[model samples]
Structures are given as structure tokens and as C-alpha cells.
Target: MKRTPLYDLHVELGGKLVDFAGWEMPVQYPLGIMGEHKQCREKAALFDVSHMGQVILRGENVGEKLEALCPQAFATLPKGKARYGFFTNEDGGIMDDLIVSNAGDHFFVVVNAALRHQDIPHMRAHLDEVEVTEIFDRALVAVQGPKAEDVVGALCPAARDLKFMETTVAPIDGVECRVSRLGYTGEDGYEISIPEDKAIEVTRALLAHEDCEPAGLGARDSLRLEAGLCLYGNDIDQSTSPIEANLAWAIQKRRKEEGGFPGAERIQRELAEGPARKLVGIKPDGRAPARQGVEVQNLQGHTIGQITSGGFGPTVGGPVAMGYVAAGHTEPGEQVNLIIRGKAQPARIVALPFVKQNYKR
Candidate 1:
């Protein structure tokens, strides 16, 4: 398995290493999943996300060319700003979700680590005349939580002015970095792109802050689950459409009307007429956790859907989950049952984000 630039640092921090998307990544640390989860919620936590792919797109009409592949308003995206989007297949199913930032002279894209091969090739094939360059010399680190700004701002004062979804070229200890004020943990934070050689130094500096500590994948997954965020392979895949995944908000008004992307027809149709199934939050009663692949049944014990992501939410103070269910049965307060271990467990469909998002708009 491939090791990220910060692999050694993670091991030194007592992180339990595990295989993730062909890379040996830290799943948790000595603080454990619960401790790290609460730490990020109440303060700040640093995540080693160097395994993800970072690509630079340039050339004439770059955003226009990119529109041919996905449904997003890239052409109109202002400089120093970031937007969340995904690649859709001919069937309107999500190929992979990504974050795109307009860096004035070029566009920077961050894709899921597992789908870099598939996503990069797809971009080169469809985005004609665009220079697609992948950056292998940088290691990505995310500082996330309510106190993230304080920890990061102390190193680079310029970063404090960046609002959520904003991006800027800044420095940490005089070393250049691409800082984006965004994260998946539903907190006010930033993802810093630093040189591979300086990754450990920058990470160590951030961890030195009183509010910042190292967190791993275990806490990352649980935090995103509580935030009602979708995981690429688990909550969404090639089989799930953007509309069904509750991500229509990411499709800007112009893209929705122009309809030039791969699955425009199907997406437009789904927009006009709702999808067959919709992704919604599931709240299991009592303490038993409902895990992925568990069948979701209606009150009469009829299978209606299945859980895609589930776990004990440290912030929600209970078991939280998200899954796709029959569109007609997606209303909040709707009763359902999760088939855990061949037995029916009572559950309910609630509004997404068991805990409110804390983005610094």
C-alpha cells in the first residue's frame, strides 16, 4: 500500500494504521475514535489527507471545457473561491465528488483518493484542450473544528480573512501553501496544500497549538456521518444520481438550464419529476447502532431501503445514519425499521445533519 508524506509522523503519534483505498492510512490514534471525535467538535484536529489527488487545470476556457463533464457553475466561479461538485456518468450516476477552486490563472481540483485514476483519465478524455496536471509533490492537511481559525491564523495571518468556500495562496512558516477554508466535518476549518518535504514540519507546527491534535479516518468518518455528508463509495457511487443523493444544490442554476453535461436529459427529467428514491437521515431508537448494508423496512416489515452509512454520533449523542429510501417515504418523522442481525429494529427518518453545520459563512 502507498504511504502518504506524513506516514511516519502518523506512526509516531501512535496512530493505528490500516489499509484505505490502496494506501496505508491511520484509522485512529491513541486518543481513540471517541476522543478524537469530540476533540474536533469542541476544538481543532489535524487530518492527513495527502493520499487524495490534487490536479491543476489550465488553458483557454478551462471552466467552460470542464462543464462538459460535470454539472456545476465553474465558468462563473470567481477567483479565490471553491465549490463542491462531482462527475456524473451517462446515467446521471455520480462518478466521484470533488472540490474545485478557481486560483485566478488556473483551477485546482481535489478528488477522492480511491478514484484518482478513473477521475483524472475522465478529465483528460472529455476536457479537450485543457492542460490537466496532477500535483504529486504536495501533501494535503486539514485543520478542522471551531478553533481551527485560531490555530491556523497564528501561523499565517492572511488565512483569517478567508470565509468558508474561499481559497487563497498563503504561507506557513514562510513556506507557500494553497489554503482553502473548507472541510467535510461541517466545521469552520481549512485544508492546506503544502510541499511534501515540508508536510511533517507544517503538521507538527499545527499540532503544537493548544486546540489542535492529530485525528484519523475513524473520527473523520463519524464526523462526516453526523454532518449528513456523503461518502463517495458508501453513501454515493456510480449507481446513485445527484438528485437522488440530495446534492441538487451543488448544480448551479445555469448548469441546470443549459444541460450540457453527460446525463443532462436524465438529470433534467429527475429535476422536473422527483427521483424514485432519495437520500435521508435515519435515527435509530435506543443505543444499538445500525450499520451499512442493513435492510431498512417500513412499519409493516416491508423492505423500503438500506443503510449506507451508520454509527454512534458523538455530537448527536445517539446512533445516526443516512441512506436512500423510497421517495414517497422520505418525510421527516416517518417511521421505519432497520434489519440488524435478522431482527427488525425501530428507526425514523429525520432531517439531515443530526448536528447543525458550523461553517463560517
Candidate 2:
């Protein structure tokens, strides 16, 4: 497995290492997953996410040329602003969800670590006119939570002025770094990209703050899940359309009218007619914790859907899950049963994002 530049630091911090998408990543620290999770919710937590893929697209009309690959209409996307989009196939299936930032001279894209091998090649094949370069000499880290702004601001005052989803090049510990007010944890935080050699130096600077603690993958997953964010392989895949995945919000209004991206026809049809199934939040009664692949059945005992991601939310103090169900059963307060351990457990459909997102807009 590939190891990130922070692997040795993770070991020194007594992180529990695990294999994640061909990378040796820290799943938890000595403080435990729940402890790290609560730390991010209540204070500030730092995460090493260097395993993710970073690609730079440079050329005239970079965003316009890249729009052919996804459903987002990047024509109106302002410079220094980032948009969340998917790399979809011809059939409207999601190849990978990515963040594309229009950074004046070039477009910066960040994709999931597991799908980098496929996503980079796919982008190159479709965006032949644009210069696509994979950046491997940089390390990415996230500082997230309510206190993150103050902590990060102390190091880089410029970051405090950045609006949500806005990005800029800022210096951290005297090392120029790309800083963005974006995160997956539904908090007001920043993702910083710096030279690999300066990763430790910058991380140490962030950790020096009394409010910041080192969080691992375990907390990251739980945080995103509680935020109602989809996990690429588990909640969404090549077989799932953006409509079914509740991602229509990412598609711009003009793009829906003048469709030019892959799967335009199918996606438009689904948008008009509605998808057969929809992803929704599920709250199981008690704390049994319905897990992924658990069959979801209606009150009448007929299977209606299955759980994609589920776990005990440390912040929520209860079991929270997100899954797909028949469109007819998607209303909040709708009752359903989850078959767990051979017993039918009562569950209810609820609005997404069990926790309120506190992004600094």
C-alpha cells in the first residue's frame, strides 16, 4: 500500500493504521474514533488527506473544455470559487465526485483517492485540449470544526477572509500553500495544500494551537455520514445516477436546459420524471445501529431499500444512517423496518443531515 508523507507522524501519534483504498491510512488515534469525532464537533481537529488525487488543468477556456465531461455548467463559475461535480459516464452513472476550483490561470481538481487511477485517465481522454497535470509533490490536510477558523487564522490570516468554497494561495509557516474554505465534515474549516517537504512543518504549526487535535479516517467517515454526505463507493457508484443520489442540486439550471455533458438525455428525463428511488436519512429506533447492506422493509414487511452508510453518531448520540428507498417511502416520519440480526427493527425516514452544517459562508 502507498504511504503518505505523514505516515511516520501518524505512527508517532499512536494512530491505528489500516488499509484504505490501497493506502496505509490512520483509522483512529489513541484517543479513539468517538473521542476524535467529538473533538471536531466541539473544537478543532486536523486531518492528513495527502492520499487524495490533485490535478491541475491549464489552458484557454479550461472550465468550458472540462464542462463536456460533467453535468455542472462551469461557464458562470467565478474564479477562486470551487464547485462540487461528478465525473459521469455516457449512461449518467457517476464515475467519481470531484471538486473543481476555477483558479485564475488554471483549474484545480481534487478527486477521491480510490478513483484517482480511473478519474485522471477519464479526464485526460475527454479533456484533450486542456493541459492535465497530476500533482504528486504536494500534501493536503484539513483543519475543521467551530474553532478551526481562529486556529487557522492565527497561522494564515488570509484564510479567515475566504468564503465557503472559495480558495486562494496563502502562506502557512512561511510556505506558500493553496488554502480553501472547504471540507467534508460540515464544519467551517479549510483544506490546505502545501509542498510535501513542508507538510510536517505546517501540520506542527496547526497542532500547536490548543484547540486543534489530530483526527483520523474513522472520524472523517462518521463526520461526513452525519453531514448526510455520500461515500463514493458505498452510497454512490457507477450504477447510481445523480438524480437517485440526491445530487441534482449540483447541476446548474442552464446546464439542465442546454445539455451537452455525458448522459444529458437520461439525466434530463430523470430530472423531469423523477427517479424510481431516492437516497434519504434513516434513524433507527434505539441504538442497534443499522449497518450497510441491511435490508430496509416497509411496515408491511416488503423490502423497500437498503442501508448504504450507517453508524453511531458521536455528536448525535444515537444511530444515524443514510440509504436509498422507494420514492414513495421517502417522506420524513415514514415508518420502515430494518432487518438487522434476523430481526425486523423499526426505523423512520428523516430529513438529511442529522447535524446542522456550520460552514462560514
Candidate 3:
């Protein structure tokens, strides 16, 4: 397994290491998952996300060329701004979800670690004449939570002014970083891309601040799950379409109307006709913590869907889960049963994001 630039720091902090997406990363620290989860929610937490893939796309008509490949309307994306969308395959299934920022001279892309290799080849094959460079020399880190702004602002005052979904190259403690005010935690935070050599320096500077704590993948998963964000392989995959994944909001009006992407026909058709199944939030009556692959059944014991991501939400104060159910049974307050340990546990369909998102727009 690979190691990120912050592997040494993680070890110093007594993080529990685990294999994730071909990388040996910290799953949690001595603080544990719940402790780290609360730290990010109530205060600030820093995450080592260097394992994620980063690429730079530069060339003439970059926006126009990129719009053809992505499902979002990249042409309208202003410079120094970021947008979240996925690369869809020909069958309308999600190839991979990505975050793309439109820098002045080039577009910066961040893809899932698992799909990093496949994503680059797909882009190079489709984006003819575009210079696609994989940036392996840089390491990525995310500072997230309610107090993230103040913690990061102390180091780079310019970051405080960047609105959500905005990106800019800024200097933090003399380390030049491509900073984006975005994160998967559903909190007001910034994702910083810095030189691999400077990663430890930048991280130490941020951690020295009293407001920040080191969080691991355990907390990261719970935070994003509570935010109703889909985990690439768990909640969404090549077999899931954006429409069915409840990510239709990411598809702008122009892209939905123009229909030029790989699965435009099927995606647009699903948009108009509605998908057969829809992703919905499930709140169980008790705290059994319905896990992934658990069968979701109707009141009559008929299986309707399956739990994709489920766990005990430290913030939600109960078991929270997100899964796909028959469209008709997706509305909030609808009753369902989760087959846990061979017994059916009563649950109700609730609106997504068991906890409300706190993005600083």
C-alpha cells in the first residue's frame, strides 16, 4: 500500500492505520471515531487527503472542451471557482465523481483515489489536444468545521474571503497552495493542495493552532454521510446513475438541456421520466446501526432496497443511513424495515442529510 506525505505525522499523532484505496491511511486516532467526529462538528479538524488524485488541464478552449466531457456546464463556471460533478459512462452510470476548479490558466481536477488511474486515461482519450498533467508532486489536506475559517485565516488571511466553491492559489506559511473553500464534511472548510515537500510544514502550521485537531477517515466517512454526500464505491458506482443517486442537483440547467455528455440521452431521459429507484435517508427507531448491504424491506417483508451506507451518527444521536428505495416509497415519513441480524428493524424514510449542512456560501 502507498503512503501519503503525512504518514509520518499520522504516526506521530498515534493514528490507527488501515488500508484504504491502495493507501495505508489513518482510520482514526487515539481520540477514536466519535471523538474526532465531534471535534470537527463543534470545532475544527484537519484531514490528510493526499491520496486523492489531482490533475491539471490546460489548453485553448479548455472550458468548452471540458464541458463536452463533464456532465456540468463548465463554460459558465467562472475563473477561480469549483464545481462538483461526475464523469458518466455511456450507459449513464457514474464513472467517478470529481471536483473541478476553473483556474485562470488551467483547470484543476480532484478525483477519487480508487478511480485515479482510470480517470486520467478516460480524460486523455476524450480531451484531444488538451494538456493533461497528473500532479503527483502535490499533497492535499482539508481543514473543516465551523471554526475552520478562523483557523485557516490565521495562516492565510486571504482564505477567509473565499466563498464556498471558490478556489485560489494562496501562500500558507510560505508554502504556495491551491486552496479551495470546499470539503466533503458539509462544513465551511478549505481543501489545500501544496507541494509534497511542503506538506508537513503547512500541516504543522495549521495544527499548531489550538482550534484544529487531526481527524481520520473514520470521522471523514461519518461527516460526509451525515451531510448526505455519496461515497463513490458504497453509495454510488458504475451501476448507479446521477439521477438515481440523488445528485441531480449537480447537473446544471444548460447541461441537462443540451445533452452532449456520454450518457446524456439516458440521464436526460431519467431526469424527465424519473428514475426507478431514488436515494433516500433512513432513520431507524433504535440505535442498531444498519450497515451497508443490509436489506431494506417493506412492512410486508418484501425487499424494496438495500442500505448502501449506514452507521451511528454521533451528531444525529441515532442510527442514520442512506439507501435506494422504490421511488414511491422515498418520501419522508414512509415506513420501511431494515433486516438486521435476521430480524426486521422498523425505520422511516426521512429527508436527506440527517443533519443540516453548514456550508459558508
lDDT values for all models: 0.94, 0.93, 0.93
Lowest-scoring 10 consecutive residues by lDDT in candidate 1?
Answer: 61-70
**What are the clashing pairs of model 2?**
none
Q: How close is candidate 3 to the true structure, as a TM-score?
A: 0.99
| Candidate 1: residue pairs that collide | none
Local distance difference test, candidate 3: 0.93
Query: Which lDDT tens digits does candidate 3 get at residues 69-172?
Result: 77898877899999998998889999999998999999999999999899999889888799999989999999999999999999999999999999999899
The CA lDDT at 160 in model 2 is 91
lDDT string for model 1 (1-361, tens) is 9999999999899999999999999999999999999999999999999999999999998888888888998988899999999999999999999999999999999999999999999998888888999999999999999999999999999999999999999999889999999999988999999999999999999999999989999999999999999999999999898999999999999899989998888899999999999999999997999999999999987889999999999988899999999988999999999999988889999999888899999
Alpha carbon lDDT of residue 197, candidate 3? 96
The residue ranges of model 3 lying beyond 4 angstroms of the native Cα positions read: none
Give lDDT tens digits, candidate 2, residues 1-361.
Answer: 9999888889998989999999999999988899999999999999999999999998888788778988898867899999999988889989899999989989999999999999888878878778889999999999999999989999999999999999999898899999999999998899999899989889989999999999999999999999999999999999899999999999999888888998888899999999999999999998899999999999999999999999999889999999999989999999899999999999999999999999987
- Name the lDDT value of residue 239 in candidate 3: 90
